[model samples]
Target: MAARAMHVLTSRVGEHNAVILSQEALSNLVGCSERRLRDAVKLLAAENWIEIRRIGGRGTVNAYVINDRVAWAGARDGRRYSLFSATVIAVDDEQPDANELGQQAPLRQLPTMYPGEGQLPSGEGLDPPSQPSLGGLETDLPARRISPPAGSPFDDEK
Candidate 1:
């Protein structure tokens, strides 16, 4: 149950270590019968491990303040000799409606093609000239090749 409490434990300014889970919900979370859960709660109280603020009558949730001396998830100052200020309620209701779930934009339809489909003619895509024309530019001179400097390691490779 402490492990479960850690998930919902609050660390607000004055609500440190408070868990506002319902008894039924806590029982379900701990995987135990409600009777067993009550017994465990009693035991924990006897050992000063926790303090129950409310028994949670109809339309209300059971409130528990875990002893920070034993387990705490908030800053030390918040739980150090502090009192409960807020709660963390867990709802056990039906699944939310699609509208309550919020709106989602529709996905865009992408173009599709089958295998070997939409083939281009063999010479159509090769319209660009293989070698760009250098109109009126001098191209008769041979490319100058600079040889490696003498006595350099690169000269030895040749």
Candidate 2:
């Protein structure tokens, strides 16, 4: 389950360490049964590694807040008190298949924005064009090197 939490860590968003995913989705991600997932949740909560804010229901999804001390990806100042504003919800990958009557066929093509509609606030024009050339963009620094600090035992200092 710790491994699963690490995987889900990538999906966390906002200033808070929170993720909104369904039990089924989590179970599938963890390669475990829902029962095992529940048990792991209990253990993690008992260890103060996570907190469950809300359980998913009809028209709702499970909400979880990981202990910032255990795993944090945002600024430290607002982690304790801030609520998640930017959330990325995780759902099952498999879409519902068509039944015998073929009433629920999976959609093949989704609609996309017409060229200029990608801009926010609706009225803004397209962004500036990319730079045409890199003539003046040369860097003076040498290729990056990975080495210990000069004073460290691994350093090449005499």
Q: Which candidate number would show the highest TM-score if scored against the true structure?
A: 2
Q: What tens digits encode model 1's per-residue C-alpha lDDT throughout 45-82?
A: 67776676563347235666765532335567554433
Off by over 4 Å in 2: 10-16, 55-60, 68-83, 92-158
- Per-residue lDDT, model 2, residue 36, is 84
Q: In candidate 2, list every pair of residues with a backbone clash.
A: none
Q: lDDT of each model, Cα atoms only?
A: 0.56, 0.59
Q: What TM-score would every model get versus the actual structure?
A: 0.39, 0.42
Name the runs in model 1 displaced over 4 angstroms. Answer: 1-15, 68-83, 94-158
Cα lDDT tens digits, model 2, 24-53, are 777777788878887877777777777665
Each candidate: how many clashes?
Answer: 0, 0
Model 1 compared with the native: what TM-score? 0.39
Q: Residue 69 lDDT in model 1?
A: 37
